[model samples]
Target: MKNKLSKLYKIFLAVGMVFSMCFNTLGMSVVNAYDPSVPKEFTRVKNIKYPEWWGRKIPSIASWSTYSCKYDGKWAFCLEAEKKTPASGKYPAQVIENNENVRKLLYYGFGGPAAYGEFAADADLKTAICPDDPLTNDDIKYLLTHIFLSGAYSGQWKGFDENLFNQTFGSNYGTNIMNIYRRIISLPDPGNGVSWEGNKSGNRALFKASYDKTNKQQVTNTVKLNGASSAEVNIPLASNVTIHIAGTSATQTGGTAKVYGGQSFYFTAPCQNSPSNFVSDNICGNGCERFTALAIHDGGAGTQAQGTWNMDPDDARLYLNIE
Candidate 1:
């Protein structure tokens, strides 16, 4: 009787252990299941041809999914997508739009989970600018031209007409426009021989004055010292300003050159003069004349002295820190 009881007890213990193992395995499988609603996989959409206006390549390892949610007491369909790199140095997240009116698709690349939340919140995501409306080719052309010319990153946009831009592009489109510009500007120079520099605003600002070499048609701000042996060029002052002077010679032949407002400051040309008889001395190359800068306080109108200096009006170009 004792032996039979032992056998039965062993059988019961073995069955209990097997049941526990199975339960734990099932729990782990449930916990590890992949949620299709969430973007978990990062596989490329194969054989998809991109549009010219897309401006950026589609990222690898992205997820596209649809969700149905209630909005304003009605069911609405929301599309959510995102992509990210396994490591850094991938493109930053961005939202792209295809505004076909009937079939709208919003592409979210590298935006991650937060972007998905924002996208999901918009029940009528098709109404959002850029994501649904998409930027027109003309809009892109205009923005690129203006940014390259006006130096958008350098607080130049501070003076821009915000109302007109908003009205033209829709609300908050300015930010999207800037984001595209930022991406383009961040790219390598592409051997196009163009370069950019950071402005006081700490943004990479294009040097419009560098690429466009044509002289201003109207020299309104210039103070020309034509054939003046000794004269001070009067500049109407607006606050404290730094004066830029371009001329044929680095140093005055006889008299001294100084800028005077409430106080006087002197500046020497850091570059050499162009070859004699050049049409415009503003060019600071081997055959072109050079310019220099001098700071002046706001006393009233400031004066830049030729001081018995000899140079032609065409031989010099003067500009102030007005804009």
Candidate 2:
């Protein structure tokens, strides 16, 4: 009788897959909106391909199942509250429209459940090579911040030593990562509406690329600084920002623009006489660069600012004050 029941379950699962495939072939799969209770960044994804390990590892923790998942118009993955071992095949999951339990799919809930559970079981980290326990607000912040930085600096991993972990991940990443984590996780205010930075409002100017939320494209913006001293500009984070100082001067000297967090620019103006002659200076970063503000310094005495500071699509631009 048990064998017969197991066979029947397999048959039903196969049939369900057939139906799901048919619906998808006809371009008629149900795409549900995200739950209002959770943060907006956590959207319901569909058609996430689960690996075999998902159903095979830690069977006691999670019940392995398969479901279609998509994220931001791309295929993605999802997890249940419990940790489950993975299998070789996909499984059909119930339609989870507007499900509040979906919040369990976050890092603390499923992604890092082993670490979370062990930490909760005892106030000690269990995972080797950088384990984090997401319990208190601070713990949660630490875990998410680590995730953000790990992803941001994935290629820069040194090794698996504890000291190396400290050296690799234990640096002040500043508000760039903080704001990004908050944007994604919506971390609660500490108290009295004060931010983690201990300020009334944790706000700062983020010179970001022209982004369109509707289509989710990092559209680049181009600006022409034709003898314009002071202006506001926005450009892509992955691109380089350049400034030009042209025309005759007493002697060519270098100037600096302070971006923030180890990002500064030293530009050299040309000491030429022609109006069309120009010299260029620029700063390059590891692609995730952002500037809270921009300021240009005068190279030296008797130096006149000329030429154009054109930030093309290929090259980024943010120049403020030519004098």
Candidate 3:
């Protein structure tokens, strides 16, 4: 069953690929709206899970599973959980999480029954790596793009100890997404390579390159990125928001007139510069159609990152226009 966790990794990889493609088709210079006040009707949580051996600061030999929720037209929840590594005195378990829309898949009850039974029977699974953020947009955003850095362990086993290929997950979970994102999106803060389009009326987003989220989105669009190389872009707004979108060669949508609100409006690429291209001077990169985050965290504690391997080093920012 440990090997099943690998499948989770593959599924997330495929989802990310589709996100990139949608961005390409949407074109650059799209609006980046962020309103923590308006919830995206989605939720996410992340962390690195280990066995009891991990609690005693010892080595653990176990497998794990992960979960993901698509909100804001992208990933709302992306969890990478490690299953219990079996041993004589070892234990195992998995938390039974709940969601509204998706049905409970029968095979998703427990990861390992060994230590989990004892631990859960005693106090609950050993670790929960719950998000530090409250139930808000910021918290949800952080849960999906973070990575577990400590998963890589380094120490001598005994007196004549040698190197090993193990790791420690995170604090509340595995790693602090803030540190992870700070490292990934810092280089190309002004992202512009991707080109895509968002049909406001259809409430759909289609990427043109690396990332894709057509299947996962619920309301708004989510632009995903690989923490290490790619850029992180998050856009959160209300359903009636005056939003705008465009690509390098995209055609205009509703002209320059204000659509949603009286003064607030949404215009396509043909009329103005890429709204995503805005960035700082020194730390900013020489890219187009990109934006940096104003703050680091997603309302919770650490930076708002979700997946175990998908945390961005920077606060993937999404710039937008209201008026």
**lDDT top scorer:** 2
Model 2 RMSD to the real structure? 27.0
Residue 48, model 3: Cα distance from true site in angstroms? 11
The TM-scores of all predictions, comma-separated, are: 0.16, 0.21, 0.21
For candidate 3, give the lDDT of residue 243: 34
Candidate 1 per-residue lDDT over residues 1-323, each given as its tens digit: 01122455558658967986898888843221212122221222212211222223222212221121221121211121111112111111111112221011111111111112223333232233234334433232322332222332122332233454455456555565455444444432211111112221111111111111253111112233322122233333222222344443332322323332112222222112211110111211111111111111112223110000011233233332212
True-vs-predicted CA distance for residue 176, candidate 1, Å? 1.2
> What is residue 86's positional error in candidate 2, in angstroms?
21
Instruction: Give each model's clash number.
Output: 3, 20, 79
Off by over 4 Å in 3: 1-33, 43-63, 76-163, 166-187, 191-323
The sequence of per-residue lDDT tens digits that candidate 3 reaches over residues 19-52 is: 7678877884444344333433343324333233
